[model samples]
Target: MLRRLLGSPAAVSGHLHRSLSTHCVSTNLRRSLSTAASSSSHPPWAIIDYNTLVDDSPSSWAPGACFDPLQPPRVSRISAPPHLLRPRERPGPGTNLVQLLTGHVTAASADGHLLLTYYDIIAEGPRASWNQTADMEVERFICNPISGQLLRLPYVSGSRKRICYHRMGLLTQPGPGGARFAVADIVSQRERVIDRFLPELGRWDMVVGLPCQPTPEREMDMNQETVAFGGRLWWVDLTCGTISLDPFSYRPELRFVHLPTGSTLTSHIHTKSESAEERDEVAKYRRVGVSEGRLRYVQTSLHEPFVLSSYVLDEEASSWALEHQVELKQVLADGGHECKNRPPQIAVLDPMNAHVVYITLGEQEHVVAVNIYQDKVIGSAPLQNRYHYLLPCVLPPSLGSSQFPETGKKGDMEAIDVLVSCGRHYKG
Candidate 1:
């Protein structure tokens, strides 16, 4: 009966108006039958030759997945390399989008716009090798998702001054594009440590402030070590060695925490009698990132690639406790260089999403991107230039609108991009 429907090999091929490409026709038929049986309600095994049931037509796809049929086609390919679009691709009466040179970027959503944190954009002249002729400038790119436009805050307060801690990055969503971001800066003109706000709905506001502290010299470290989680800004203080940050509710709290050590993760592997020294060493840690108002970290003194440790913050008691410790080797596979570098800096790429992508510079100065979700090293690339990088942000999602809006778009997909930067190399 089965053979009767398909007819003979030559007859079936003729019916389909095509020749069989593979000799294993019987095996292919078996698999096709299995799939048809699995979803019998869909259709029958009408030997269509190829099994690519794709309708790339925008009309066949769901709404938002494609564009409206009434409007002209709104989709087209985005060309790169020789076609890598330059800013002012065609000079017109439009906004000057922030040009991201070789640097780190992390964008998240804030009030519906893309809050893009772009670090120091160093200048490198192709002809002169790498010689800078000007002072560094810190810039923040705020792109409105709806308009597909970006705004650059090149100078703070519209003056020649720069923003504090432009290296590490500003807070936003967790991806490779602009979302939204919040920053905390102390007023230099006025002696008040204040929290600045830039909500999706309106302008910046001084929402919070600290008592007082001695200001560092111009060249010294003045950046507030900040991370965004539970919806607010928080940081690790080197002077006090404690975390002072804002929660999702916009309240500030200070907590003491420590990172985990390789020794600790190893002891868990084997050993009934774990040494006291090993235990003591593992217990001591530093702030890494926070999750659900809980603090997380990794061992600082560790000279080798090890595990990532997170500590949960006990607000009532004002103390820290261990939460999760996943072996860094399990993900990194190769020994991480951040362990080789002295004071290691690592941050959970996105806390909202369980897929944590940690960014750290290794001994060879390779910036590694580790995936916490799949337990693997997703990306490892060398920094093009040199400047002690402070912040690296994972950008948020955006419209990434199709170039030819006049063309009704077809099947489009989502993607993630990363932003990172070294210090001020080209002063220009």
Candidate 2:
């Protein structure tokens, strides 16, 4: 009876045989799973990537992975005076745990803890004039911060013009055979369209029905940052509407939803003719992000004390509602010097903890966390100025390899090579 319930060895290994026959396991999957199964028997660690600004040194632009941000010190359970509990010290400038390749990190998979970066290599010498278009070769790569495994992705054919403006995102999950992952991107210029990379097929597939047209008068652009929430990928337009796509569907679907009336992010925009400087000034004060599985909008004013207004998307009502409105003075008592020059760039680092938000202050590039619910500053860390240009991604804890097969026989290796080389393409 026990043998029947558990199945014989042949029956137990049948699934593995089928996976080998189908050639579903990829090189990345094999490497990641094997490494995880052999490594220390501990939970996977969570980390974040901090992409620095341009620097003369070739290596300075690489991302710095940090593990300390999410692991706050724990308090003792033993009874004691509150004052006796030592406060947790903030991370210093030298706390970066790992340094990755130099490139523009375009997307991050919070679930898988993977990073996608785009690097442009000038094939020819410098052009004589800035207006002259030079030969540019673009390369895309995805890397695992924990394992330091990097894979070069095949080039996707399209207009290279304004490639820097393109947006990318990653999604991953365990499949019947092994782990599967997909990378998606949106390029908008002449026409708006979506492209996704399917690992199983090893090719790019385009999804239609995206509302890419921007009114001639507005000339709006899609925000470069993307959020993967509730099984859909979301992108916010500069004009205040969101574009969502379901990548896993048989025929991917795209939808756009407008922001609520009073919660419109453009409340501060002025229609009157103004100098280029004034227009750029207003653009610096607004940001869009996701928090607690909902879309969030943050807007700040140019005046003193920097009043910040935050809004949350009310999914059921199909609208946004004002969530928090707090002045910088109320939170950061000193009102750091950077506040006077420009508004801080805001990002919701911990969506699970809706109260905390990450903000980047001026030239100094001090990354600080503020608690909206408590109405106080929580932590502060000095970010190197060189890493300021890249977007900050909050990666969740690693999903260790223990979930996959611990070992594969020689036959499995042969099968994977044959399958990968054939370049079989599968459509969702």
Candidate 3:
């Protein structure tokens, strides 16, 4: 029947014309899908760059997943900057330059609020006189990228400085009224004390009497990603394990959960010997996250015959049970790439899919999503830089623009009150 329709000269001409029109439309559509493509059509989950942002276009500042399904994941150069209420003013006609570095996404709440610290530097007069005229101010705040609401946090208790240098985590606890928010600070390196800043209270409360260090010899170093899971804030060390405590508790006790045996650096590597650079290299291959309603850990072997392994935490046994282990040689081959001597860094685990993981491969740092269960590469994207720290934020249907409630108004008051008390005027 199909052949009969095309057998006639008139029918053949009509079909060819339609095919040509369809091809043109598809070509134009592909051309329009650039980095600034409409984000409403993309998935909610995105690998957000910690320090990158596009300040000109306020709407595009929210990180939206941008990658072509047919092509390897391509880096979108114009990333959504953290939407700010008070943008910096342009430099005057004189030799003046105001540079703003958005800094890094230090931590994130499971609900999607990001804890960011940035520096605003202004230099006036002339290029040569920058040393004398430059003024830099540090700003730390939490914001919901989806909602575009930001709240600058008050200074640490009794500190004259505007920014706190300690490791911080965004805390969210669901309550009968609503989810209460706060920031948890590991106040001391040698002690288990924490300073939690409650927006409602408008002050930082010092939390003490927590458990001591898990390993007295191995000092606690929490420079890795902080995970908010199971009603506690987990401070992870890629080389060792995690120490977690509930910020909401009046008298919270710290608990230690070590990485699965053979997964971490040897017990004898003291804090002094294991430098920050060494710890960072270790983190490139290993990651711990909450996926599929379970705390999971993933590690890619540093040696040849490279292996990618995953384990899930068994709270009952206080250990990680092996879930999946697959050699990368076959996986890379399937992805139309070759396995190199060095394994790809583990980018992120799919918060919604238990079997999917993203790994950055090659010097170009193409991000490839592989399904460990199937041992196949599902998707790939190229990143602008290999050093970008990705923070995964899964936005569920329930998440909306009004995620910030009346409590945000109180937070604003707290910010102003602190500035007044310190005799410092609010910059913005």
Candidate 4:
């Protein structure tokens, strides 16, 4: 299907196959840095990407961050430097077209950093014919949008090639020199392993192997976003619960915390049978995030007398404490919307405000901010895309200088791409 749609990978443009270089910052980064410095802002923003194909519209390729702390939440797009979009090192002059497929805003940290996965296809050519399937390149980046600084992470090697399945997240630790960060890749299969990448070390270290599964009854389905809270990275399986580990610990210990009692799926047989689209639809009603320095889980009941329930994890990582429950029907009626049957999609948890949550209501997906405590709709705006991965990020007080640090070992780029049904091309 991808081959028929993309018309043989040779259809890519020159901008896609360019070689990567060591430039501190591009003109775009400098402009963004200037803009961020002057703005007085709130802590968290709703970050999402336009997963649609790239056409003549430039905004389609960029990821957007929606700021709702103040009234009328506004959204702005974040653009990547041209060099970061190309191959880290040139394969050859004969390299065929490498289509920039899409960008996934996989995770975010407390320090306003984002973990991005760029999907690209290396067209089959004489030099690139080692594989038959699309040469999907695993390009992982730690980007601070406010600082306009970006760091391309080194690829994890020594095992089989890295695909898009491994769950990853960004972990940040502030130090005297500057804010240091690490990438936690939770590789789960027959066995689960944790890989940590610190810039100072310049390579991925296989930290430890989990002694046992998070649950003995069924395997974990961790498709939701990973949360960075309390100096640890929390990988969430929305239907099940969450598994957290402090990536910085020398002897990392994995801990499991299930969803609020009665929220977890009792059996995996039904969940496993649902298609990916079905799973995404289910995610719209459930989410876990950090708010007011505590881990919170929120979900909307599927049946009527529709209710939105929120829970906060206890300090000891033992269990979840029920926080608030807002009746969605009453809220909708108060807001003057008559569509009682339309279920709302849980967009994001207000990282700074424990009582407020964001949701996309109706078919238009109008982004609405709701205060669960008061059952009031405070702010809203229309979102262009229906299917999106929304991430809540806290922008720092001041932007950091654009300093592209050295990762010691030369970086490697693996080429394998999957083209979705989207009709346009997107360059990230």
Candidate 5:
């Protein structure tokens, strides 16, 4: 009856086409059915069997049953080259040098060759009392580590005799062909002031006042470096709160942002120190840095198996979130480091990658790079140990002389003044 209704070949084709078009069957399903029917001539035994037969014997074993999916991934190890293992040399003229000063470290521009350093003088004269001095002179000068070029920062006219250099932050603004950089210095005398050095202006000008004044107790406890991130300068106060200032703002704007609670690393070791204050001070170790245009906070303990906790600023929430946590012992073991000394001190997070960090092991003479993302030590480089002080700074290649012009004869007087007044600040 169905054949009679279809009638001729044209009528059958029309009926098939109408069925397919009307969703009787999909085109792919029809094609697959036709192909399977055409290939069904072979015997079942002639077809190659690709599936493995289940082994039910007592001696037989299955590998998948023994596999553990919860196991941690293995870590990769990297080695430093022979040249990097040797003591670092002083950067020559026109070379990029990231100089680490007494109380501060530098973050150099990736495109610029020069590193900014300063000359400071701390003179101690007759004292009126044991804690107070009769006369103190503080002079500061900005200098280039590569060319030995010095530029005297104009002193705050009619300021107090005692002045302290609090912290410095360097920010580079990208321009058409090259970039321009600005330096913000926090100087404290009777009052704390923020001074900015504009490359175009060629002089230090007071920008704004600090939100909080520095007392002798808090002055010694400030972070060594002020980080430049999110178009502002940030300093971690002694209480681990972040203080920020906008240098480009028309009004003097300063904001204090409290870090999220429980973000700091705490130690469980009980010290035998007689003073309870000393024990409290030894309970926490913190470092503030910038990574990937965001502010980062790092905390670790002073003992072995030093566990590190890292956090990044959450801009939307205006808080910090714990990002990474790892043990220093595991990192050292993976790096083939067998030093019996104290655990390395985390210096700063890599600005280019948030997962990498720079650390300085005590008296090791080399800076180690650990990639927390991969759970390994990627590399190490010898640090330039001057005056037994090892300041590990990452220095990129210099751009050119046109970007950072040499300080010629006009800077001669400033260099002379720095040499004469800053002699006492340098310790042999």
Candidate 6:
């Protein structure tokens, strides 16, 4: 489990969808830093990535990983340099015709190499069993984020039907003595429309209408991102559903569960102290549950900052649905949709502690930590666009806790983080 979680190519885009809107949220955080600085006020740079949340001792999670208090930090008003420009125009990534696609996503890739993009493309169609053969074949490509090195898996030719690509994550599984990179493609065996491929194995396979679980196949209507945390993969199903993938399992699958009803969440909000104006504002934003268990999608018609929603997953369902009864308000902070929707690309790592989501934001070539634990934007920095976010992953035997530094402020020794502003992509 430790090594399998660490090996990936890097920078695969994944993310969740917003409620009551048509726009998409993604995490390839590309910043064109060379462009002129605009009037737009950038985010604050004071908070350190690691905080001394606990007073006396260092955070329990601090030792093996880094709670680097002295790490270089970014000043509030300063912005990093711009990104290197590409030819002004040409065939860019994701612009090709025969590409694997869906509108919504949650987490893109667990490691850097095999991206685990997600979609609520499933519709409320009908039921299918893992045992009951739907007779489908699915296929998709696992492409390189940079060179576009694609490994195409052969299609089940002349099958008279298409397969569906459910979801995939780059896994470093314990193969005898060590970890090996593998793409765990959750494909629907039914003559599913989506197909998938493994670049490492040089193999082809079918994707499907449903996963390996026993839930009835439903047509998902929305888009969502795929996320990796706690040694597993997770995403929100179109109907505000969240799915968790077991990283340790051989035949990878999501144990489905249901989320709290939207009304259950919104109705529970105490409107008592709210002013009429505030009440009106509250109406715009509600804490509606998204994933099964305790998580909710806290979205608003009003665009203030980001609001955080969180959940717990029940590991025993066949189809995607909510699980537990313990409700958590979690982190209700201000977040612009930029982190999820605005990235040019993204990468993820289990990092043994909590999930570390890396997006190269700005035209500046920087990685941004938009939200951690649902509330705070831990840190940000200017980084190479070509650099994969997967390279720094740490496997579990988890060194310590996954939380960021307890001390919100950078140490006196060095700055804790940095930021980069993006410019327009250069058309050569």
Q: What RMSD value applies to candidate 3?
A: 15.7
- TM-score-best of 3 and 6: 3
| Candidate 4 per-residue lDDT over residues 1-428, each given as its tens digit | 23321222111101122121223222232234344444434433544432212222322222222112222233334444333455335346666654444445667887777776555555555423424566665566676655444566776773223653456888888765556888887776246578888777777888546664355355665657788999989887777788888888777777788888898776743465664445455676899988888999999987765799999998788799998898887786787654447777787888878988887777745777788988888877776544354567776554333223443234442211111111111121
Segments of candidate 4 deviating more than 4 angstroms: 1-44, 50-72, 87-98, 122-132, 158-161, 212-216, 270-272, 338-340, 399-428
lDDT of candidate 2 over 292-351, digit per residue (tens): 666777766556677777778777525578888787754676534346456665533445
lDDT of 6 at 211: 51
- Cα lDDT tens digits for candidate 5, 156-268: 44342324344556665566544455667556523556777665555556854555422322232233345566777775552446666666555545566555576422332
Per model, how many backbone clashes are there? Answer: 42, 3, 9, 7, 0, 116
Query: Where's the lowest-lDDT run of ten residues in candidate 5?
Result: 64-73
Deviation (Å) of 404 in candidate 3: 2.4
Descending-TM-score candidate ranking: 4, 3, 2, 5, 1, 6
Against the true structure, candidate 3 reaches a TM-score of: 0.74
Q: State the displacement of the C-alpha of residue 266, model 6, in Å, after optimal TM-score superposition.
A: 14
> Alpha carbon lDDT of residue 331, candidate 5?
80
| Candidate 6, position 65, lDDT | 11
TM-score, model 2 to reference: 0.63
Question: How far out, in Å, is residue 248 in model 2?
Answer: 2.0
Q: Local error of candidate 5 at 393, Å? A: 5.6
Q: Estimate each model's TM-score.
A: 0.40, 0.63, 0.74, 0.76, 0.53, 0.35
Worst 10 residues of 1 by lDDT: 70-79
The better candidate by lDDT, 1 or 3, is: 3
Residue-wise C-alpha lDDT for candidate 1, range 1-428, written one tens digit per residue: 11211122111100111111222112222222123223222110000111011112222211111000110001110001111111223223454322222212222222333333322222223312322332234344443322223344433454332434321324444333334345444333133334354433233445334432232221111122345544544444322323334422344433333222232232242244643233222322343444333444434335444556555555542445665556674356554443533433452323433345444444325555565546666656554323222222221222332111111211111121111110101111
User: Which residue pairs clash within candidate 2?
Assistant: 52-387, 53-386, 53-387
Error of 6 at 358 (Å): 8.7
TM-score, prediction 5: 0.53
